[model samples]
Target chain A: MQTMVETRNLRKTYSRPDGSTIEAVKGVNLEIQQGEIFSLLGPNGAGKTTTISMISGLVEPTEGDATIGGFSITKQSMEAKRLMGFVPQEIALYPELSARQNLAFFGRMYGMGGKALRRRVDELLEFVDLADRQNDRIDTFSGGMKRRVNIAAGLLNSPPLVYMDEPTVGIDPQNRRRVLDTVKLLRDEHNMTVLYTTHLMEEAQELSDRVAIMDHGEIIAMGTQDELTQQVGEEDRLEFTIGAQEIAEAVFERIQGETPGVTRILFNPPEQLDEDSSVFAPALLTVFAKRGRTALPQILQELDSAGVEIQSVAVREPDLEAVFLALTGRALRD
Target chain B: MRSILTIILNDLQIFFSQRGNLPGLLVIPVLLTLVVGWSIGQIGGGGPTRLRVDLIDLDQSGMSAQLIEDLRAANDTLVLCPLDNDAEDFCRLDDEPLPLERAIERARTGRTSALIVIPAGYATALENFERVVIDYYSLSDPLQPGLVLQSLNAVLQRASTASMIPGVAGALLDNVISAAQLPPLEGETRDGFLRALYLRSQQLLTERPSPVSFRVADSDGSSGSVLDNGFSQSAPGMGSLYVMFTVLGGMSVLLRERRQWTLQRLMALPITRAQILGAKIGVYFTLGIVQYAIVFAVGAAVGMEFGSSPIAFLAVMAAFVLCITALTFALAPWIKSEGQANGLVLLLSLSLAPLGGAWWPLEIVPEFMQTIGHISPVAWAMDAFHDLILYNGGFRDVLPEVGVLLATAAVLFAVGIRGFRYE
Candidate 1:
């Protein structure tokens, strides 16, 4: 496959008023192939947006360069920008203008005009399922509707590559599903390369052909789901959702020592609620074992005799969540 | 270039769609233009503007009344306060009697141009061949007297001339009688003849134009009496004032675009940053022109003459609008919020407009004020406008003013382009 997007030591730094500097994206490198869905998954403030912004030519890279279809973003910005469409996380449409007007205006900016521009705008509106409400102002539309229109705007030129920066943020579950399906369609039917950034691990697990997990402005891991999970070894993860009562350390020690095929055991206490409230976040106890299904009954009997209140229990396989936890000693959400 | 035009069209469409902008753009400015124009009253409103002079006829004698009539004939621009037909109190004095002290105070304070006191026994003093004094009170400059003082002097000089004529003629008659060895004529007959002679001389002097009776005209030889109500002043004056208001308003809108992230989105487009900046500048410049056109149309409706070259007029308008638009951009980057932008707009517009004499003619102010007024771009624009509309000047005459405006615009555009924030 041909390379659709590539970066060489891409970095960005910003200065504060007191002459202090912050490195937002640190010496990052990435290569995305044509006709594939690539996702950068991380928590908030992990330089996901910053990396995307640098690639889209919205911001200048401090130390290195990125290329869109081999066009350098800094030197040949106009050409690079022409080859890709950028969907910002915010609703970038003019609120006072109707959906159709906003689309037409952006289309004109892309050097498309006359009847061709109008027809393309019409098609995008229909594709977004907002054809009936095209004449309504964007301010009057719901959040999901505006998100759909925003996606349509980026698709106006139909370039070979598209970058969507959290397009499903602040939307309903149904709209999120629709947006995910739309991303799949872009790769499946249109054969267009997509660079999608999101914090939701589930989103990355579902849509991405390949994923790069970033943290603190660095990519911690990258590969297909199976390949990334293989790094943590073959061990089934057993999760026990427990109550506010703390499990004795001896009980955890006994589970790993006495239970056969059990490799390691971990416990995460629930976060403290306010003093006045009776409720608290449930704690979690995870156990990794070679044959987790064979060891589940023995673990439950141990917990019951130790006076531990088990709210729920589940037996799982080694996945991205488990891989993240094993590699960094932190949960994916952390 | 096409992208620039497209952005300009889109922004302008958004500006006009908002109902809140109409009053500032059209209604308030037009109404204020008409109101301020009518209040000026001088040129062609069909309402004659004349200096008010309060006269106290202490003599209440026939000669005093005659002297009053002569003063009127001396200068038509003077509207003597409290005339016999002043039923409407044209002097703005409510029905109270005008005292000599009060009239003197009025003249001293410049509330009235001047006051004239016709002393008692003015006819007896002239008839007896005695010297008499007529009192004049005014705040007019001593070295360069205004119309009121000049008219008073001319009328008084004629009165002195009339008074001396009889005495000189009497002395000559006596010399001729003695030399020819003939009897002297009767006193009553001589007195009657001299009286008739004095009246004839006074009539002749009053009938002729007073020394201050000349009409005002422009250097370009245009009729000074060219009929334009105050619209010539008010139209361009208010137009420039509101141009600042309308164009500087873009600062807030630019801030809004940034806050809404549309500006960032536009920067992400294939177009260059310069094109986006140019389009934004064009938006405000176009709005400024629209504002000027509205006021000028009202001026035209009232028959205000736009001097010899319409192209010069257009150039002045364009240069001024561009300067103001550049000013808007130069200040937009420092704006932190919509409220701050709004406050800056009002502060700059209000201060700059009046400082440059948008409310009235700069000529009416002091020499030092006129010099200081040039600190405002509106002053230069108003100067060019006055040359074109009032002086009947051509493009060459107003080029210096236009050049200054464009130069200021160039400087501001430099700073603005350097400091403009896209995100």
Candidate 2:
């Protein structure tokens, strides 16, 4: 397959008002093949947006460069931008304008006009299942409806490459699922390359053909689901939620040694829910074991004997979340 | 270029689509033009009211008739009582001759505004180029001349100047002949030659049109008819004020666009940043011109004069609109919130509009205030409009005002384009 996008040591540094410098993207390198869905998965503030912005030519990189279809984004921006569509995280549309109007305008910006632009707008509206609401002002539509139109605007030019920066952000779950399916449809039916950025591990797991796991402006891992999970040694994650209480650190060590098949253990103490709230959230204990289901009862009994009050228990298979935790020593949601 | 036009069209469509914007863009401006125009007309001595000035020509000479004609020409508002008198048939020969004393009594009692008495021998005095004392009788105070007295004085000054020119020229001719040691001509022949020379000189002065002229209407001496000068001043004034209102309102819209990320999306397109900036600027500029057109259309409907040069009028409109558009863009980047942008728009428009003499003529203000008012672009635009509307001036007359506005626009555009926020 031909590479659709390639980055070389891409970096972005921001200068604070006080003259301090902070690196948002640190010497990142990436390659995405045509007709594949590539995901940049990370927590909030992990430089996902900055990277996408640089690639989309919305922002300039401090150092290095990115090329779309062998056209350097910074050097040949107009040519490179013509080949790709960018769907920003915000609605990024004129709310007073109808969806069809917005689509036609963006289509014209891409050099499409006349009946061709109109036809493309109609087709995209229908594809997004928003044809009935195409004539309504975007401000009058629901959040999910607006998001669909935003996605449709990106597809107006029929570009081979599209960059979607958290397209599912702030929408209902059903709409988010619909957007995911539409993303899949783009790759499956149109054979278009997609670069999707999200902080949700589940979304990246479900949609990406290949994933680059980023943390603190660095991509710590990149591989298929199996390849990434294998790095954590085939272990499953066993989680125990306990009532708010203090527990000795020795309890986790004792439980890990006594529970069969258990390889490692991590625990989190109770936390305050909010600034004004007096209630404390349940503490969590996560155990990594070769066979999580078999070891759950033993781990629960060991915690029970240690005088730990258990609230709930769950056994999770090794997935992106576990991969992220294993590599970064932090939960994906953290 | 096509992309820029498309962006401009899209922005305009969106702007017009909002029903809330229509009142500010169209209705209020038109309404204000009419209201303000009529109000100023009333303030300007009740809308072209004609002053009734009675004329009692005891001399009944051709010179006295000519003087009456000159007064009639000087001010349309001067209603010569005998020429326009109709109620009691007082000017008819069948009725008893209205005496000069009665006319003066009528003027003093305010039945007529003023009375001019041309005594006997007026024609002989004028023919011989001798000094003539023409009595001007009026109830108006000499310190504060009424419209009738002012018109009378203006015509008399021209007459006196014409009369003096012949005597001066004849004396100079006589001196020249005597200096050359030529024999002095006998009385009849010399007088005839001097008389012909004076007639020719008077004709030459009368043929040349006055550089300054007024366009007041002659009323029936009851009260003034509705004057168009009020609308003439109000149309451009209110139009410019509303232009500032409409164009500066773009600051808030632009901030909202940035917050919505539509501006960022445009930057990500194939179009260059310059194209997007130009398109945005074009949108507000077009709207400003449209706003002016609406107000001026109202002015036209109500009989307002657009001066002798329509193209210069359009230039003034264009320059002012461009300047305001630049101001909008220059301030848009520093606005942090839509609310702040809204407040700033109101503050700038309200303050600048009044400061620039949009509410009244700069001529009415103090010289120091007028100098300070020119700091506002609205003042420059209003000054150009006044030249076109009030002075009957052409393009050349308004070049300085237009140049000032255009230069200000250029400087503002430089700052706006340089500091523009593309992302």
Candidate 3:
């Protein structure tokens, strides 16, 4: 497949009010191919938005360039932008205008006009299932409705490549499912390239053709789901919810030594709920095993002999969450 | 360019569509223009009219009485206090006897436009061709011509010319008698001839234009247009005030646009930053022009003169609007919230409007204050408007004012474009 988007050592440095500098995106590089749904997964404040902002020409890179369809975003921004569309995280539409008016205005901004602009606006309203409410003011719409119209606005010019930055944020489950389906349709039916940024692991797992795990301004891992999950060596993860008191180091060593197929055991201490409360949240004990379901009975017997109280437990999962944990020694959210 | 215009049209549509903005743009300003336009007429006449002059006739002779009558004829607007009494004590006297000392104080304090005091022996001194004294007192600036003083001067000049005519005629008769070696003529014939000569001279002087004629001229020595029912004062004055209110209001809208991220979204399009900035500027400029147009339309209805050059009138309006639009952009980036921007709009519009002589002529303010009033761009605009509306100036007369406005606009545009936040 032809490369649809490329960035070379893209960096962004912001100056603080007190004259200090913080590097938000440091010398990052990426290549997204045509017709691929590439996802950048990272927790909040991980610089995923910043990198995508530079690539979309919404922000000027401190150093480096992004090329879209053989056009440099920095040097040939107009041409680069002509072949792309952007749906920012915010609802980014005029609240006073009707949904149709907002779509028509943005369509004109992308150089469409007259009947063509009107037709495209009508088509997008239908595509988003908002044709009935197209003439209603955007401010009067629900959060989900606004998000739908926002997506419709971004696709006004029918660009080949589109960037969606957390398009489903702050919406209900139904809207999230709909947004996911919309992304699938973009690639499956239209053969369009998509650069999607999200913090949710489930969203990446369900929609991405390729995934890049970003943390603190750098890409830590990249590849298909199968190729990436293999890094954890096929060990199904086991989770144990215990009482407030955690097992001691000796107990942990004993469990790892005696339990067959148990590769590693990790214990987390209880966490205080708040300053006003004496209640502490339950501690957690995670044990990774090759055959986690077969090994669960032995792991429980070891904990029972040590006089430990277990609240609940889960058997197995070798997914992106496990991959992120294995690679960074922390959960995706952490 | 089409994109720029499209953006401008969109913004204007948004601005006009809001129901809350109508009063400021249309209803309030038009009503204020009518109020201000008529209020000035109440203070004075339709234009520059009557000034009160207090006269004390100490001589009480025919000559002094004649001087008083001549003063009235010289300028009908000079209403002599006490002699020409009315219910309104325009002379500022509290019905007290106007002793010479009290009258002097009135002139000194500007309670009256001026005071003319004739000495007790003025008529006798004038007839004998001896030195005559007339005390003229006022608090008016000597540099600016005082109309009351001119009226008094014309009366005094006629009196002096009358006194000299007799002396010159008497000398000429004596010279003719000596040269011809003839007997002396009778005193009756000689006195009658001199008296006849004085009467004819007075008639000729009266027939000619008075030295104190109220024909106002420009600094360039051109005749001026008269004010029509005070619209000259109110039309441009209120027009400028409303222009500030309308244009500075853009600050809040610009801030709201940024907060809503509509401005940021525009940057993601194929449009250039220059186009966006140009369109934003154009929106405010067009609104300002429309604001002026509305008020001036009322002015036209009320029969206000726009001087000789409509083109210069338009140039003044356009330049002023551009300067204000630039001002709106230059200050927009510093505003953190829509409320702050709204507060700033009110503060600037109200304060700058009055400071720049939109409420009244800067000439009425103190000299130092007039200099400071120019700090507001409205002052430059008002100056240009005054040149055209009040002074009957053409395009050339307003160039300096228009140039200042445009130059200021360019500087502000540089600052605004440099500091404008797109995201």
Candidate 4:
């Protein structure tokens, strides 16, 4: 029940070269439960890094507070830093040192020593699948291999809470998958709380138990996938082919009034359909019958009189992508 | 503490892991000690040190010729060139002359040292029992010129007095015989008188000698070589210059630690920043002490003797180390990169070495230059060292320098710590 990571009205402001202020992070308040894999999603420069930096104690908040493992990040910096392992956006490992040496160096920095330190380093290396490359210097490794070692170094001391900021950036697909799998394994095996930040919505959707979508330094939405999807709820979408031009106003109104499941209605007049349909009456009859709305002969008669063309009709369920689009009013990618 | 130890150990490992970096570090210290130490005491070893002096034959008599021969015999070290020849063989060979334009061109184009000229009637006046004036044409001002002239005059005086004694003794013997009213005798008497007079003149000339006159050019020579008076005495002083360079290396290590983010990682542990800084300073102090010990021991082995108390020497060296450590810390804020730190360390350490009397003694420098040297911690340290090594002074003599160094170190340490950043 403990909150592994928490922020209260956290805000950070940076001064620009033109003497203007940019609010990098603003009024972010959230609680991440212990051993939970929490993912934060945002566009580039959307305060994701700033928020992580504040929580990790790498940067001080311009206003408000953050805590890691029950210790205030600002007041109890060392204690908070001790409890949280931060894998920065950039690889911080020394390129000249071998994997084992890099691991040992970071491990010892956290006060780990002796046989225990060696054991931790070995375990972490094995988990990252870089056991074979453990003795080779990082400069010699490929991008994927180096990334694996980078993750391994972060896991050296085995802090209960680890924050990975774009951990799989600039890596091959194979390595990216390896990193994602490793992160999942670490959580499941060690019961470690993870607060991961990425701009990839799919990555967040796949790995996060709960996601907080940040935009322009604000958390626009935060919830489980179901809860957020329900934000655009599972509406029954019904599409109808109605042949109409002039005489369908009353019929359309009647249809709208009668159907309780129709979430949206689009009426394209017969003339608007690009079809080989000078025969509007036959197409209309077929469309109504196919829809099991044959009892509504008045609508067909009205569509035939209006000379409307009926091509196709269908209904589909609202998906998470739709929900995100509905909430943000822009494609998740754009 | 453990975290700091890890950092230090890791740093040491990284430093030694590379075959190149280790050799570079080791070579710098060794090369500086050996090359600098060996070259310190060597004065004009590649050639001769010339003294510029003018020759004036005021006597112009046969007696003057004898005087000149005696002068030449007195100090074979003197190169008695004629008036027409420029005595600035050292300055001329260096290609640098008195004028800045000429000196620059010559320095860029040729080689030389100094100039000497002879005034007319120098020997004639000497024969007349008047002081002969011989001009020394040098671009240097009074102090060096005056000192060289005094020493040269002493040599010349001994020679002239020896030459005059025989003539004076002959004249005195003739007077003595006449005063005794001895009758004019035959061939044996004349021969006997001549032998007695010759022997007596020889004895008189050997007994007492007259002083010689030496005149120095009143013009202050712009050629800086005139100030190159103390190479023989300043070699040990030069050796002290490099102590700062070694200490500066310790500061560079601090810069590298910060740049590498090792300090930040260390601070994340239980250890405080102050503790880490203290450990670094402590290590550097230890290193400095060891370096000083080796240098002093080696110096002693090579016939450089210290004062009665070795404690004074050790204390002065410790003070020097402390001062350098402080200066290094002060420079920490200003050095943004490892390359910059290294460059600054080299430039500052080398530049200050000469100014601080590490290359030469302040005693031989111009008055203003001596005053300026007081501003250098190395200067204060060198002065204290000189007291210990050259004068055999005890702790009391070095206390002032120690206090100054301690104060400077304290100030610099405070500033350096204040300016330090983890990344």
Candidate 5:
């Protein structure tokens, strides 16, 4: 397989008004192959956007460079940009313009014009299932419809590479599922390379052929699902929901020492949960162990002896979330 | 180039698609031009209001009478006071004399717009081919001479030329006859010859058209004269004022585009940043031109003068619109929110429009205020338009104003394009 996109030590630093500087992306290196879905999976503010912005040529990198189809993004930006499509996280389309108009305009920007541009727009609109609403202003459409049109605009040039920066954000579950399927269709049917960025581990897990797990402006892990899950040594995850109360750290230490197969444990206090909910979320305690089901009762007894009220418990197989938790020592949502 | 045009067309389509932009772009500007033009026309009484001019002809000779008649013919709007003043009354020897002091006082008290005093040379000075000084008095400021005074000056110019030419020619003839050592003609022969020459010269002068004629047409297609109407002022005035309104409104639109990330998306395309910036500027500039065209079309329908130079008129419109569009871009990068941009647009348009004499002529303002008003680009544009519309001026007459507007636009575009925030 040929590499469709590559970045070498890409970095971006932003300067503040008071003269302080922040390194948003720290030496990101990526190689995406043709006809594959490569995911940059991280929580918000993990340099996913800055890295993507550099690769997409929307932002100037303070250091290093990226290439799309071997065309340097910083030097041969027009040629590189012509080889890819960009679907920004924002709706991006003019709200007052109809879907067809927006698509045609962007199509012209990519050097497509006349009947060819019109035909491409029509095909993309139909592909996005928005042919009926193609003439309606984007402002008049629902969020999902607008998102679909936004995605369609990116596909106007029929480029072999596309960058979708959290394309499923702020949409209903059904629409999100549809977007995921569309992303899959692009790779499976059209033989196009996709660089997908998302905060949701499930999305990355379902869509990505290879995932680069990012945190704090650095990619800490990159591998397939099985390769990443194996890094934590086949440890099952044991989760406990406890009523909101102060639990001593010594209790977790005691459980780790006494349990035979337990590897490590992490606790998410209730304060870290959503503030808007009327019902209080229970404090969570996650324990990684070989055969965590055998260690669950022991962990529960240890918590009960410490006067911790147990609300519920769940034991799960290792996944991306567990991989992130094992590597970062924090929950993916945290 | 094609991408730039596509962006402009795209923006125009978006602007027209929204119904809210119509009132600002077309309706209000047209209605304001009409209402303001008609209202100002009413202030000048619709037709040409006759100027009250008091004439004290101390000479009371046939020459002075001809001067007065010529003044009346020069401007039909001038109404000469004192219908029956002869040499006795003019020389202050009549039983009930209207003295020069009283005539001067009438002019001072605004009873007359100007007063003309032809001194008591009594025709002797012109007969001898000597210079004579006519004492002219009026309360009109020299800086802003009144219409009556202008008309008086015009008539006086013809009178001086008509009288002087004959006197000079007769003097030269006498000097030539004497210097040639010919026989010197006696009093009646010389007088008869000079009188014949004077009469014939006056006849020729009268036969010819007045050197300067005022042809005031009813430009509005109404019974009233065009001089009294304000369409010439209001068309460009309100047009420029609303051009600022419509173009400066781009600041908010630009901010919204940035916030919504459409600008970012455009940057992500295969186009250069300069192309995007040029296209954005072209969008607002084209809209500004369209706004001016709509207002001026209404003006044309209602009879407004576009002056002798159509190309200069277009240049003025283009330069002013470009300046305002540059202003929009220069300020757009600093605006934090749409509400701030909106408030700034209203504040700028309202303050700059009135300050630049968009609502009234700059001539009505004080000299210092006029100097200050030119700081607004609209003032330069209005100055150019006034030269074109009011003075029937050509391209050379408006070049200075156009140069100022273009220079200002260049400076502003430099700042705007330099500081423009693509993100």
Candidate 6:
């Protein structure tokens, strides 16, 4: 597989009033393959825009080098830029001009003209689902419609590599879904390589072929979903409250028998549930079913006979949000 | 290049699509021309002040009354308002010697153009060839002050000649002087001698005579059409004043293109940042030309003669527009907000027009102001236009103005290129 974009030890330092410097991007080394969708996930102020700007040739990196489609970002800027398209976090469109006109203008800047230019403009408008509103002025458009047009303009020249920074931000759910589906179509139909950045964990997981989790300007983890989760090992996280050592032992056996691949089970009691064997009551049966609750008198009777009286129950598993929390130690938005 | 054409098409589209902007851009210039044209005709080169004349007769005699009637018969250009007063009632807007102080004050305040005081026996003076010792008063602004004096002079000349005609003069001088040397003979020759003598002298002139003539012309004419003169000069100055609007509007392209992310997106494309800047500058320069054409049309419709040489006016206006266009591109990139651009445009427009002689003619302004006017492009443009229109100057007269404007445009273009940014 060919590397469409590669960053080698890229570092950016910003000086502060105290004469100290901030390392916004510290020695970031990455490679993205052609035709692959890559997502970079980070919270606010995590140097996302700065990194993207360097890659897109909008900002000059203080150190290291990036190559886009074999063109060096610093040394061959025009070529690098020519190979890529950028959609910024903020929606950028001319409010005074019609949507179609905006696309046509940008297309022409890339040396497009005549019938070819017109065809490209039409295709982009249709691609973004803005064909019907092509004649409407952007100022008259809804926020979502404007954003779609912004995306369409970015695609006017049909560059093979694309960078989208928070493309779904501030959009309604229906529009968001449409934009996401369109992105999928771009990848599936055009074989376009995309570098998608967002703080939304679910979106990143859904869209990215390879996810890179960055925090405080540093990528702490990067891999496929399974590969990254596997770093946490056989960790289908399990937990239950227990009132007695005897009941805890019995609950452990039940969990071991019910769920395959169950490796380690731990019994812990909350400070408030002390001396109550009923704490492991309902939870003991849940382990066997692996469901929140099984509405059955038989199960309840069995738990009572087994001396596992119900008080409280809780179970945990390793999902994307959990994995992210484990790595960053904070919520994605923060 | 292609981008330039696209940008022009975009501007034209917006201009046509947006009805509100069209009225101010196109309709107002036409309307200004029509309104100002009609008004100029009504005022007749003077602006808009009517003529007022006051006759103060101290001679309550029949001849003095006849003199007043002749004064009233002249024409509509002069409004003869008669004032009567005792010495005690002098300052009351009525009465005669017309109170020297009151009459002077009334003329100064524009209540009367001139006061005709029939001094004690001003009629008797005419009867004796002692001279009709009439007193006159007038203010300074009227270009027609001479007209006022001329009318009063005509009335007095007629009255004096009337008192001297036929037997009236012959009866008094009949015993003392010969009849062959006497001026003329007529019936009530006292009544019409003045009118006939004035008429006969008018007929013998080798030169075509104006309605009123004197040995020495009055330097101050009547204040007939003051605003007309002001508006003519003011309209051209407004050309300079409103040029800033184009500059402001041109600079708006930066924020607009930047906001649209067009700049950023363009940079990402195969093009250079310079290409984008070139396109915008090209577009706004075109806008500046459009603005100049509109203002020129307005000035022309108002009957402001730019000059016999159309090339000179076009060259000067083109140079000025280019300089402003370059200035717009240079300054626009540095300004971060639309409000700041607006404030700069307004401040520059207001201050530059006055300095450049748009508010009034530099001839009436002080020498120091005239020198200062050279600092603004508008000043150069006005000088060039003045040479062309007022002086009827040829292309050579406008060459220096064009040179300076071109230099300014070049400098601004260099500076603008230096300041441009892509994101």
Docking class of 5: medium
Q: Which ranges in model 1 have alpha carbons more than 4 Å from their true place? A: A236-316, B40-229, B362-373
Model 6 lDDT tens row, B1-423? 675576567656665577766655567644554455445334443121224566666778866776665555543355555343324221233333445566556665444556677777865565554655677766534454555676666766665555555334446544444545765445575446544543343233213333343332221434333433434554555665566666556676577667766567666666656666766766666666776677767766545655467787788878887888887878877888888887888787778877887655665577788788888888888777665554345676568789999999999889888877666
- For every prediction, compared with the true complex, DockQ reads 0.61, 0.77, 0.57, 0.21, 0.68, 0.38
**Per-residue lDDT of A168 in model 2:** 96
Ordered list by TM-score, greatest first: 5, 2, 3, 1, 6, 4
Candidate 5 per-residue lDDT, tens place, B66-122, comes to 878777777776667665334422212224445788778756644455678888883
Clashes of each: 0, 1, 0, 38, 0, 19
Put down candidate 3 lDDT per residue, A59-169, tens digits, no spaces.
Answer: 899999999999999999999999998988889999989999999899888878999988888889889999999899999999999999988878888989999999999
- Winning model by TM-score: 5
True contacts kept of each: 0.75, 0.96, 0.69, 0.25, 0.87, 0.71
List candidate 5 stretches off by more than 4 Å: A272-282, B45-125, B128-150, B153-223, B226-228
Rank list by DockQ: 2, 5, 1, 3, 6, 4
Say what the interface RMSD of candidate 3 is: 0.9
For B191-280, candidate 1 gives per-residue lDDT tens digits of 888777777776776677665442332223233333363777789989999999999999999999988879888988898888999899
Lowest-sum lDDT 10-residue window in model 1 chain B: B214-223
TM-score of each: 0.74, 0.79, 0.78, 0.61, 0.80, 0.64
Cα-based lDDT at residue B328, candidate 1: 95
Q: Pull out the clashing pairs in model 1.
A: none
Regions of model 2 farther than 4 Å from truth: B45-226
How many steric overlaps does candidate 1 have?
0
Candidate 5 chain B weakest lDDT stretch, 10 residues: B85-94
DockQ of 5: 0.68
C-alpha RMSD between model 3 and the true structure: 11.2
Against the unseen true structure, what C-alpha lDDT does each candidate score? 0.85, 0.84, 0.84, 0.63, 0.84, 0.67
Worst 10 residues of 4 chain A by lDDT: A281-290
Better of 2 and 4 by TM-score: 2
